[model samples]
Target: MGCATLTPVPEAWRSVPQAARITDLCARVSCASRGATDVKVTDGKLVASGKDLTPQFRAIQSFDVSLERREVAFAAKRSDNFDIGLVSLDGSDIHWVPEDPADETDVQWAPRGNKISFVVHSRTGDLVRTVHIPTSFQLTADFPYTAVRALGWEPAAERYAVVLTSPEASERIERLKYSGEGRESVVAPAVRLDVAIEPLADALLMRPSTLHYGERLPLIVWITETPFEWNDARGALMRNARVACAIVRQPSEAFWTAARAVAWIDLEKVYVVSGAPAPSPAYPGAPLSATSVVADPKIPTGRYRVDDRIVRAPPAIVESVAAGWIAEQLKDRNGPR
Candidate 1:
């Protein structure tokens, strides 16, 4: 027998009304311009831009954007001088925290929204400074260069990675440490470069992550044949070109040996590669290709299939493979329920 038709409820009767509705959160955006070197953002209906500006250089640098305080901050170099400044995003107000006339490199936003940290150079020597904000930001103190280079904040900004560079060149991996202000101590030593530090695509390329999210990651270091004229060494010489990664993180000492590669697709997203490379010829030198390229998410197995003939992996496939490997690591580390 066929079922009987039932009466349907009216649209007005079925619809439910809420006592109150929540509005959307305001978006806080900040950007830096080359011509002005000014950081700007919008606060509510008003637009604000910062001052104490300088000409932008080709090097990749970043600034802090505080939505809570509605301000933009960045480091600037003028007359061979480095300084940090905060200003309204609309160009109405400006505040400057200038550094001593010295070489300042790798200025970055502190994990906290209210402070900035950077490498500073003075007549005495090179140092690192962490500056407080709002109630007049200023340099708090100077830390050793080793700590400065390895300085990285934890996910929550509460802790930092502290690395020490040894005076001896052979002891490259012996220098890195991870700790807070009062508990400074070495966490790992004799770490391999490929395993110790991972490079971020945006940071290594000297470009913003937003613009290069899907682009191929560049090689941080490569062994390429050097021109004979440039090299005084008699035989065919190969030189290592060091490229800095955009972001770096220190994993627990236990997992250090298993780690093989580190990469960043965007500011917040990170991917680490591990496990042994496939046997050579069939898989080549490293199971992974020479260059760390960004991959597409839709690919099979989350890794790139190499075309051995050209000795190059497609950028899109590379990113996908890296992403897949990272996903697998997360699963294994987290464990299944």
Candidate 2:
């Protein structure tokens, strides 16, 4: 019998959420404008009434038109990151939507135009935040998967349909109903969180099997594209000391969610070791560049480099280097061991 090979199809033919979302937005824009005038990006400019609505230097990423044809919501690159920009049809009152400092994309206006929704790309995962235009009140919607390409809001219900990719590169459309909950911070003592996260991916949260009464420990969140057996690393670290380690498999949405959810971890001593380089201006602290990142005034940030040597070496050596780095981070201060 001859062996047969099966080749996978290209991603372009598999998923096109961005194009589909843009098409839907364009249709809405066509219907809302009513042919009185036109609103669209022409010559790389947001043009309407024969004028450019956005700054000449900034690049437009995505945009949507209001139902009344009065305002345009668009995402543009200001400096290193993207911010949602709003401007009137007449090219007046150009401003940005008040939101967190991250790359916001896929701007969409709610059915009533009173609210705007966009995806915030962070080091942890992709978050869909809807902000009230009047009050600037923000509500967050978290998903179990990353790589959200498109998001749509329902008119009558507080629900969002998100198009995302699974770990196996298959496209999925999930409908989530948000009640302004699910993202609240936990304040209790550190213990196993019995969070009933439906469809939890292969993300694992590891800690010392036992902790002394009222004792907190430092946490190392290792984000990697490839998954490795953590038994050796966990055994080495546990034997050295009581440092908690979490492994976030690639394309999983539980990066900071799993780390921050552990209330017992010493927030000040939390370190991030990325198998790949940290993205630019994505995390709370400085970009993961050197051995450690300076704090971001609000949160601590650091990066650990896993060079070629570490990658080729065994898991024990890789994690041993991490342990040394963490100890160096806390050496100056009398912090958690």
Candidate 3:
């Protein structure tokens, strides 16, 4: 037999393909030294004045520069989550900001470098955390909205604006006033209720591994009657499939109504897997028409009649079955992956 060379398949064609990119340098170019030096993070390195200053080992998510001190405040992945760090303009000296278990992003320097602020993503809710550099004092103000990023700080560092993203992926600016001891409240730019109130504050959202920018994908909303927790099977569903999942607890009519407005969701492929009986007619004239329903066998089928189409499976294989069904539905629609 003649010797032949084997060509490796492209990542897109592989079943277990890696993501195209996972860099944290999402922010734009930041200015330092009173606009004398232009600094930014790219390819895991800090570039200042067209020169790479920081080491390439650390993965930076978002960053800001202090004009007074000539230091860069950046958020980088520490372990499972992200942490804030400080680096000199020369990249020779590095300091650690106060670490938190939750992921911290959008690091911003105060006007005089006396304080720093970032948003912390906690399981229960989102918090805007501020730390004083001199006293090392930490102050946190809880917010009901999901903070996308820190916009800017006030001159006194007691107030700031953050971009809040609703469940439907719409963003709006909200200003918050901060005090050292009390819980800060929204100061200006009230929440817009023109469309629908922001829900999904308690929902646990999971995205597919190989998600692309500005790409719409199928969604599976698991409406849990009780508390939800992460397990191996649920993790596998997200890792192996090319669909977005949301675990919604105590889902209200507004949730279903707002979900229809999400620009990135393929409304035709939105499926609901409920642990309780089918929801009532309180959902604003039946806005969301779920593609399919995957009910828990333990719960009596209220609206749906159990037939041969409904396959009863064990708890271990439920996620697998759900993934397969979603794939089949996507195939039927001839949707793009």
Candidate 4:
């Protein structure tokens, strides 16, 4: 079947640069710049950029920049604590939450944009606590854990997904659910790992791979066991596995392929990255020239270069593409039928 066509953004809106900072909500062009332990947002009109509140932190783990709101939310790692903060566009109002560091893996804003969720590591680092944003921005409530590695809100804003490491097996996938709700249903499951050995005392391997939102889903690259040769084997046996995508309204079951890389754009569409030359019929004729390519809204063209060796694309680029598509879809849905 032909791919779904996404509505194009109006020229006025399309001309505006993608928002990179919280303040971008108000300004036209906003960008984020991270320094030695600090993150800042600069806008078209602003002379000075907004800086991180806790500059002494070892590192800023992750943050979301809002150009439309002129705000930034980020997490910092200190010697003893994980500090989460939200700063306004002008960098005047700073809200913070500092928690004891047990095993905090990640932090993110909730769908409503009023709260945040974070993962806290147990003292032993074996267990994790998915915590809700506390009343003081300093308090925390334990969230359910199925070995969360990464967290994100769904497009519909009603649910979220936690990319997780399975406790029962040596595998990684995503767990999806609604916030303040119970256990997460499995969104994507682990891809199987295949291994092969050669006479060079090394190994070659391939496995199923899944990328989170904006990541081209259904990636087509294999994991190399030795990190060197194509067919060397040095590790475990190979297994047959499937990679899947689980969006709120759309879910896809895809088999892993050695020549093709795929990423989830949403429920109905996917972004593909291929390393080798593209095949005819089942596959597109040539490798996507852009760094990554999405197959939603009828295969739009892009400007980035696709790297054949590495299966991953730049995160910012992926985010920009996804956001643009979402914005277009939102506009379409709101327009006259």
Candidate 5:
């Protein structure tokens, strides 16, 4: 007897089949850069300047930057619960760059471009990873702990700078290098700068204000929450509410200020920090003051606003591929009827 006649598979059955495979969907989608990486930081206080900061950025988030004025890279959140994105643009609009399967957060684009580094919040603290653009490849940057004070890269030096936190101890900045096939990371070990911002570390967050890669060795400016010390019996338990900025050069160069935000007015002869309270730092003659024409954006920013619940358009081939897969599966199930 011949096999029974095969009718169109019901929607339920169609849901399970395989369609034509899409080797690479990234090649199909295209968009221009809207300077997703154009984050402006001037010498000023690190306080919010009433800019209706995005909710996602209210907490810990990545700083945005264009590899240059022409190239920009950023991370847009795809879901409310997890951050799963890294995208780029060349002055037009942003195109999605792929992410590692592991859940990642605290994303930052490398100053050199075509690469981004992020932390994977895992059971064992935070694991750092670097995503290579256009290829969607991931390189693990092994960090000992999950708490990151600041993260940035100086491609010219062939190293990355990271500020790590030790809640029970001091906070330090360390440089790392990547080697091996997967670019496994190795810490410089001895190269580190240790600074303490106790109460601030507890109440607020930390992130690289920006890292300057220019003719001289790269310098990193990091924004830390209000500066706090031991609150010795001689003074109040907490310092007045204000932001702290740290400018560091690998060989133990660190500067501090009680500015509301910072703007790189000159960065060499004179650095600016605005909204100063009688030239703060409270050290009588500390070098923090409201001195600059540029206003700091408070928090680093990107060109586009990311919708927490991204209503994104999936790849066009996705449906076709799924449909094709389902049809093939249906064909196999029903045989040659």
Candidate 6:
């Protein structure tokens, strides 16, 4: 039996219903483009064709679709200006987020699609930042933050992982839980988030948990020239060795590590990135970055992959494709899709 029949796999997986719904949506969109609009009742709107109306967005550098929210959050850049936005699946209006994305910022949707976080460029430097999807409250780290490598969370969970490199170049993974708003009798309500980062790897490759559910966060690895020594979060900072095999090694070599799917290769069947061309490998040496990546890989273990070839896509194009996928996967189901 599938842990989730509608879903399974890393940044990638083989979802039958997902494809069927997407195909049907595409057909409807094709008809709409030809001026034959046929509307269907879905949890969310599906915009297969037309414009999302964010003309200023030059390219969608990082993006993800939230099937639960029926929306897509993305970071797009034009010249030196970068903006973040939340767009519905119906190709309607684009709602601008208040986040001031640094060149390094990549919009991330929470596993539950309730929260969003990213790195922000401040006058001092870069900082780890977060914003709730509903309330739109923002949180910024006080310290001198450098970059956000990856973020992960357990399915339907409040606890999340934030991997980062300090300005001094030290790498750490912060285990965090959303603490909601803080209110005082005198002051207005403010957002509060609890975080504790343990110095885990000098270089850790994070295959973050997906917006859709899986058993748990995927098996992350410390990069090296040889086969990966899995870095399960059980050995995370302050954790008192739940598993005896939790060996800790300092990161010496920095190889680019990313995941097409969040689960380990053995756990989920690898699925190819559908509706994508052959990977161009164009984003070479851009730095190890991962935010909200959605993929379905149907390949074997030890062959993890992601569709970075599409990273160079214009913001509208990426948003369009991702928005469509989110809308199609928005069916009411028992399993994560």
In model 1, which regions exceed 4 Å deviation? 1-61, 123-125, 137-141, 144-147, 169-180, 191-337
Model 3, runs deviating above 4 Å: 1-36, 50-52, 167-170, 180-337
| Per-candidate RMSD, Å | 20.3, 14.9, 16.0, 18.1, 30.4, 19.2
TM-score of each: 0.34, 0.46, 0.47, 0.36, 0.34, 0.36
lDDT of 6 by residue, 1-337 (tens): 1122232222211211110111122222111111133222122222334433345445566666666676767766756756677777566577778735345466667665577766665533355566887888876653342344555544555554444433122334444454423211221112211222222233323232232243332222222221122111212311211111101132222222323322332212211112223333422332233212222234233222234322111221322223333233333467554
Top TM-score: which candidate number?
A: 3
At residue 137, give the lDDT of candidate 4: 34
Scored against the true structure, residue 132 in model 6 reaches a CA lDDT of: 82
- Please write out the lDDT profile of model 1 over residues 1-337, one tens digit for every residue: 1122222322322222211211211111111211233353222122234432333433324455555565666555444454655656544445767656665655555554566666664432245566666554454344322333334444454434433331111111111112224444434333213212322221111222133344433322211121101111101111111122222212233222222343432222222222223223431222233322232243333224333211122332332233332333234345454
- In order, candidate lDDTs are 0.34, 0.53, 0.55, 0.35, 0.34, 0.37
Question: What is the model-wide C-alpha lDDT for candidate 6?
Answer: 0.37
Question: Residue 131 CA error for candidate 6 (Å)?
Answer: 1.7
Tell me the RMSD of model 3 versus the true structure.
16.0
Global fold similarity of model 1 (TM-score): 0.34
Winner on lDDT between 2 and 4 is: 2
Q: Is candidate 2 or candidate 4 better by TM-score?
A: 2
Q: What is residue 306's positional error in candidate 3, in angstroms? A: 15
Candidate 2 lDDT, tens digit per residue, 242-316?
566555654234444544565676656656655343344444431233232112222111222333112111232
> In candidate 4, how many Å is residue 318 off?
36
Question: Tens digit of lDDT per residue, candidate 3, span 148-247?
Answer: 4445565656666555443323334455565524323333222221212223545555554444688887776765532223233333344445666776
What lDDT tens digits, residue by residue, belong to model 5 across residues 1-337? 1122222323432222221222322222221222332243222111123321222332334445544533333334445434534322322333554544545666666655566677766433356677676687876766432355455565452456555543222334455653212332223222222323222211322222333453221111222222221111101101111122232111012133322123432233222212222122332322332122111222122111112211111132222222222233223355454
| 10 residues in a row with least lDDT, candidate 6 | 237-246
Clashes of each: 14, 1, 0, 37, 31, 20
